[model samples]
Target: MANRIRASFRKSARSPRAGDGKHRKDVLDSLQELRNSIEKLDDTVQRFTFYNLQMAALRVGIDLSLFSSLVESEKPLAVGRMLRYLASFGAIKETEKDTFTSTNISSTFALLGFQAAICHYANTALQRAFNTTQPAFFWLQTQPEKLALFQEYLTTNCAGMSTFLDAYPVREHPTALHPERVFFVDAIAFRNRYRDLAGRVVVQDLAPTLQHAIQHAGVEMMEQDFFQLQGIKGAKFCYFRNIFHDWPDNKARIILQNTIEAMAEDSIILVDDMVLLNAGVHWQAAQLDILTMTMLAARERTQEQWDQLLQSAELKATSIQTYTASLEDSVIEAAPV
Candidate 1:
């Protein structure tokens, strides 16, 4: 089994067609399980010790702003023991003796959201887990700095994740869309993708969010509250990405209903979110589920839950297109009943 796993890893690294993404994930998970089963008790205990120390090192490196420094330097930076430690763990690559370069993991650690997540998890979530009565949104509102960081985190996360456009064929829509009639709600991260689409893209978000958004050429920015009536009427596509998952069903329905009222007969609601399986949920999706629950008292939906939620909002999914396999990232083409 160990030999087979090693061969599979080598093949996957070298050959494009060695395995599909889903197969690769399965193999990795199996290898992990196998390692756990065969490891000695002392090694398992030592592994926990190593992980704890790694996390401490990671946090310390973030405090030093080392990751971003490495990423921005472009050329390899000469470094010493601490950097060598990080390189050994694959957080960075050792280009030469006593010199290190940033890896994707290190680059990611440099992102504001990624750094903010460490702060949030340690200072906010863990500290307040037992006693805090307020949900993450409400709590964040009181801490202006943390709120800004959280918003940046959301933007970075949305931008980095698989987009709905990759899965749904917008050009293939049956109804011809009018120019300047596409409404994207709470979407500031998809500026580039929206730029090339047939219609005009009006990005709607809260005033605070609009202030931070990088102005994209030809994209209209508008302040919006999804709980209130949608301002952009008769839009060809009323799109919401990574929005509905932040709220519970009742709250989600309110947002959907507001948009539904503004939809024309030909209009569609494009919802980009995870559509989890009833069983065998992916670890990433499961992690997000817990995150939403911790932050907002919300959960990622199953297909049945999505169907039910849309139906309650007087709409139905015309088609569900899955773009990412393991995470089940999807675009739900929805229309009013």
Candidate 2:
């Protein structure tokens, strides 16, 4: 059996097909299952967080048809299903007359994702599970909430346009002499930061989405294919925000090569994407691990994987920073080898 499995693995490994291969698909599928299991296990121990408990209880309210009962009878659910209602409306509430009602807040809890999360833990007791107890290194490192500081920047400063909505606010302001020229390839045109955001912010994209956001005269916006040689040569930074993950490796390589051609020896190819850590992967990264596959025919990469890809393109990672817990803004600062 072991020999047969190894032989099968070898055969699958040798296939020239790109993207999802038989063995690779199996591995990723199993990985998704494992992460889901881990998430389920983690939920059990997070009850002390109060928010989790509240959400869990609300899901029970849904499963018991408590919301629907409250709406129909206009009475508080003493006990059953939140059906025949949109979860976004609200969860059921108890009134002064011992009747039930719902608020917008409860509606949030009733959302399918939230409801599913809550339902998963219904009738379940907290357990002393090891998976839950494991240190959330990824969460601790990124502290995603910090990115909220720039939340207002999106509307007031950025004019509410970007590739990924929740784009990070780059603190590296532009200097006087060699103002940084940031090439945002297929990213949100943050028009606000163009003047001094690390330097002159240039946007390279073909999407009509950026037209409105390209308000500033100083910020350069280009409607060119990234597969071709990018315009800005010897730029201080060529940034691809969540762009590579949406493309297969070969296509990603082409994009990288194009960017590489325009980069200086010292120019940095900053990849603002997820860096899949080998161990202790948080649930967000785990979900994204599969999201890339289903949503796009692409895959997120680990440090080793990234290194291999960069090396193949004659580039190297100089520094890496995890700016967000969900890895929404993790930066892989790379340079030509």
Candidate 3:
């Protein structure tokens, strides 16, 4: 009888009751759901903090530029002296040594081509433009001041981009096996499109202007659509940076197909763009993707999406390499097979 009781006990221990099993599963499911919620909350807090810091830094930079150009000129001036100097320039009404009114600072900055200040005053304008409002494009096109300020901002900030491109070790890659020919193609044709308004803006004679520039750089000037590349039969390799993501999958496929057609059996195509990892998407890339969506109906892509697009274009992704620049933006080097 004791042996029979022992056997029954063992069996009961091995097999849980139905109610107990349901309760255990419920506990585990609750725990997992709680963990996922906590993780999402953490991500939200991190993103908010990052944006806050970026905005604060931008504000400081703009205020410094506006109040006293000398603050950024040769040396850092005392805040008191800077405020006094701004008052002399009629930028501020009555500047206190320790603190000045935000309104005064903002007004001065707006007049001085500070992007942060312009962004603050033109909040509605920016939101409209950046959020895909119908009137936004009109504002950007018709408002000369807005366009001027935007260009000034680009001129100041674009140096970092230029430096990154300059320092990129293009020569390290084996030139014998894969010679590189940099081709810059944009819708804007004439250099006058970039000149200041008061400058001598001549529109006539754009072809020679482009030819001269390319000849100076020892590059061929081809007015071919990137989506339909031709005469690239003999090229060893081709590279397109920040181009593919500007279009949707179908359009990007067309560009990729053209690139693939241009490649020889052993040739490579390097695409420099974002490779959004599964771990965490970078904030800058995400925000830029939003802006692109608003303006051009384009977006950023992940590695898997890129693979799918390449395969759809009848091309293969051989490898992908990621690198972080000094700035927040990361660069992805993808090769085509």
User: For candidate 1, lDDT tens digit of each residue in 167-230?
Assistant: 7876676535555566444444445655555666778877765676778776788988899999
Clash pairs (backbone) in predicted model 3? none
Better of 1 and 3 by TM-score: 1
Looking at model 1, the pairs that clash are 180-200
Q: All candidates' TM-scores? A: 0.60, 0.46, 0.43
Model 2 spans with C-alpha error above 4 angstroms? 1-199, 212-214
Instruction: Pick the TM-score winner.
Output: 1
Per-residue alpha-carbon lDDT of candidate 2 for residues 105-197, written as tens digits (9 for 90 to 100): 555554667666667664332122322332222222233443343233335532322333244444442333355545343333544435344
lDDT of 3 by residue, 1-337 (tens): 5466557545655665624877557555755665465554334444453453344334444655643453334433345322332332234433333233334444546455566444574222245436645334344555566666655654554433432233344444444432233222221222223222121111111232333332322234554556456445634445565667667788788877776666655455666677654323445444455444535566677677778888786676765555543123333333454
- For candidate 3, the TM-score is 0.43
TM-score of 1: 0.60
- Top model number, lDDT: 1
Query: Candidate 1 — what's its lDDT?
Result: 0.73
Report the Cα lDDT for residue 29, model 2.
Answer: 73
